[model samples]
Target: MGRNRISGVIPSSLGNLQMLNDIDLSRNALVGSIPTSFANFGYLFSMDLSNNELNGSIPKEILNLPSLSTFFILYNNFLSRPLPQEVRFLEWVGTIDLSGNHLSGNISMSIGMCKSLEKLLKANNMFSGPIPDTLVEVKGLETLDLSSNELSDSIPPEIRNLNAL
Candidate 1:
């Protein structure tokens, strides 16, 4: 139910829809955390929950779904926390947008494990620390925007190796 101005917490029971492949709850007034039960979306390939008031840390269980290939949780009311190491499990994910939130901590080096990652938009958050060296390993990465974060350190020289950039 995208752009429906839907308010209130997401129902965990939605996860029981085993056949669900895509979910778009963007442009809503949803509150509360993303339900852990969402991990049950075993067939889910894409999800968008942008422009909402959803608060709390992103659930790692949702990130570990093997079929998740695209995700957009931008412009939300979520708070600060490093992305889970399990985020690397989304090897099939090609695009991810986690911008315009309060997320903090280092961008995990394990992000390099996403071999298929092509576009990563993580600007306008509270992320700090040097850009992970492992980012250079994403040979297929074409669009990477880490702007407007609190990140320190210089651009890695190895970034030149990303021919797709």
Candidate 2:
């Protein structure tokens, strides 16, 4: 459910659906961290927990979902902390949006490992440090918005080769 009056913490019991392919709980008043039990969704392809009151770092287990290929959005939440390095495991994901949060730290260099990534929106957060040069490895990246953060240094010259950008 999304864009509703729903409030309170997301139920951890929702993770028991191993056959689930998509989940949309966005635009709600939900609070609390994402349940680690969500890692059990082996078939999940897309998940939207955006526009909520959720806090805490994104669960590395969710990042490890092999079937999370279409999109994974946690936008406009209260989530914080460095994005987990395990995000490198999303090799087939097409889009990832973690914007409008309290997350901090350098964007993980390992993000280059997302071989199929297209749109990566990470603006409006506290991320600091130079933009990782490894981002050039994501050849399919088209819409990369790392604006509104504390990122410094020049954009890597190699990024010019990404024709899709």
Candidate 3:
């Protein structure tokens, strides 16, 4: 469900839907961290939990889902802490949006391992440190928005090599 007035935490029992391919729970009043049981979704391709009251760091298992190739959107939530390094496992994911949250720490260098990533939106958070040069490895990246954060240092000159940007 999306754009609803639904409130409260997402039920962890939802994870039992092993055949699920897509789930949209955006624009709700849901609170609490993402249920780790969600890792059980073997066929999940897209998930949108954005604009909610959810908090806590993302579960690494969610990022490691091999079938999660379409997109994963968790923006505009209260989620915090460094993005899990397991993000490197999303080798076939096309887009990832973690913007408008309280997430902090250096953007993981492992992000470059997302070989099929095309759009990575991580603006308006508390992330700090220099933009990782490894980002250049995402040669298909076309929309990378790391703005409105505490990032420092100069833009990596190597980023110019991303012909898709």
- Cα distance off (Å), candidate 1, residue 134: 0.5
Q: Which pairs of residues clash in candidate 2, taking residues 3 or more apart in a chain or in different chains?
A: none
Residue 117, model 1: Cα distance from true site in angstroms: 0.6
96 Cα displacement, candidate 2 (Å): 0.3
The residue pairs that clash in candidate 3, if any, are none
- RMSD of each candidate relative to the true structure: 1.2, 0.7, 0.7
Reference-based TM-score of each model: 0.95, 0.98, 0.98
**Top lDDT model:** 3
Indicate whether candidate 1 or candidate 2 has the larger lDDT.
2
Q: lDDT tens digits, residues 1-165, model 2? A: 999989999889999999999999999999999999999999999999999999999999888898999999999999999999999999999999999999999999999999999999999999999889898999999999998999888888888988899
TM-score of candidate 2 relative to the true fold: 0.98
N/CA/C clash count, model 1:
0
Clashes (N, CA, C under 3 Å) per candidate: 0, 0, 0
**Residue 160 in candidate 2, Cα distance off native in Å:** 0.5
lDDT-wise, the better of 2 and 3 is 3
lDDT of 1 by residue, 1-165 (tens): 898979999999998998899999999899898888988988998888898888888888888889888664456567458777887887888888888888889999999998889988898999999998898878899999999999999998899899999
